[model samples]
Structures are given as structure tokens and as C-alpha cells.
Target: MEPPEIRFQILYYLYNKYYGGQTGKLHSAEKIIQETELKNIDRNLINGDIAYLYSSDLVTGKRSIGNGGYPPSIIITNKGIDLVENIINEIIVNILNQQDNRIVKNKIELIAKSDQRTRITKIWGYVKEKPELFVNIGEKALKLFLSGGY
Candidate 1:
């Protein structure tokens, strides 16, 4: 199975392409490749990603490959939204797992660099003692990170 994070990214991209704007929103395969900041990615690989999500019933799209075919256009399904939510929940669960996850550590480092109260040593010990605080911080950190503030 593709990892949940990768799946979430693909679903998020399609979801945003279909619904992120106030005006008309649609993206072709070429558009997805051209517009996304995802680096070193190949068109064929992304097409395969589309196929995988489509097969999982998480997205709706038509993928055509060959000489005289239209480009792929995809939209997220309701199931995709649910799966994305579940994936985010899983991310929180994983962070709350208290293992040494690199992403959470990195995010904590970012926080430490941003504010003294959120310094890694302080927040780490506090969060270890109080899981609830970690959840609140995690939610905020996740939002900030995804919003490109980190």
C-alpha cells in the first residue's frame, strides 16, 4: 500500500485543483504537473498515482495514455475527503505515539526557533508529561506548516 502521507498529498492536490478557488477550477494532467511545486516528479508517475487513487475509489478521473487521447482530469471523491481526514488523524496518532518521529521533531524544532516558550526542550518535557498539550500544539503546528508559515 502507498503510505498514507503520499496518498494524502495526492488527494490534497486533486481536491484543491477541483475545489480550491472561487471561480472555475479544473486541472488536467499537464496542469497538475506544471502547477504543483512537487519537485523531480514525472508525468507518467503522477498518472500512475491518479490510477491508484482512482482504483481505491478515493478520486474520480479519466486517465488516457497514447496517441490521440485527452489529458487526465481528476476530482476528489467524498471518500477521498474522509480518507484524508483519517490520514490526518493517523498523523496525530503517530505523533502522539511518542516515538522519535522525524517530522514531529522537525516541527518542534521549528517552533523552538520561532518562540522561546515553545522551545523543544521545554515543550518536549511538558508534552511528554501532558499529552493534551501536545495535541493542541500539533494541530496548530500542522496548520501553520501546511499554510507554509514554517
Candidate 2:
């Protein structure tokens, strides 16, 4: 189950990254609010989310050494990479097994069943374009199927 607080935090983090995090810059709360469309910015909620991320070692914060301090800049850590990898792997596995085929398939039916069809199609298309990626995915799928854990 997804927690509302976590969901909000994830959205906020993505919003910040979309705006300027990619450039190694921090966005202000107002900017985050504007981008995320969350009404009545709740400091408590934001703080809670930050705390959770911090606890998970997914982000870190520091005070800026300037006249007017800016909001803490967040960076994804190795833990964050692991988290994203796990999520992506789970999503790929789920979409591939939609028909309970016990293996990954290149059928549109299974891809369409995914909530993010466009993303799934794009990812699978990319995988198809790259023989190495396809081989890796196929190996992983075969391992899972042979293990009888699907």
C-alpha cells in the first residue's frame, strides 16, 4: 500500500527535479508548490517526508553559506538508486506477467494492462532496440520462470 505522505513526497521530489534539480540546483518551497499543485503547503507534511527520506538515506540537506539561505538541496543517493531499481524491476516483472505466462512477452495485451502504457511501451521498445538489454531482460525472466516464483 502506498502512503499518502510518501506519495506527496515522491511527487514533490520529482517536481523539484523536473524544474532544476537536474542542473544541481535547489528549488524554493513556493516553486515546489507551484510545480506540484499541492494546496496549502504543509510544513509538517514536508518535514515528515524529508525525515523519512533522510532516515532511508535517500537524501541529505545542508545550510547554504550565503546572506539569504536557500531551501536545502536534495540529491538522490545510492539508496535511492537501489529503491528505483527495485521499483522498476517490480513494474517490469508485473507487466511481463500480466497474462501469468510465467515469462516476459512482447505482446501488446500485457503492455496495455500496465497503468503507464506509454512508459511501458517506450521502455520495452528501447529494450528491443538494444539487444544487450533484451538479453538481460530475457535472462532475468527465464531465471524467474525456472525458479517457479512467478
Candidate 2 has a TM-score of 0.45
Per residue, candidate 1 scores C-alpha lDDT tens digits across 10-97 of: 6656655544451234456566656654445655556666666677677765657661333366677777666544434444445555
Q: Check candidate 2 and list the clashing pairs.
A: none
| Root-mean-square deviation of every model | 11.3, 11.3
Alpha-carbon error at 40 in model 2, in Å?
6.7
Model 2: residues >4 Å from true position, as ranges? 1-23, 37-43, 63-71, 99-150
| lDDT of candidates 1 onward, in order | 0.52, 0.46
Model 1: runs farther than 4 Å from truth? 1-6, 17-19, 22-25, 63-71, 99-150
Model 2: weakest 10-residue lDDT segment is 1-10
| C-alpha RMSD in Å of predicted model 1 compared with the true structure | 11.3
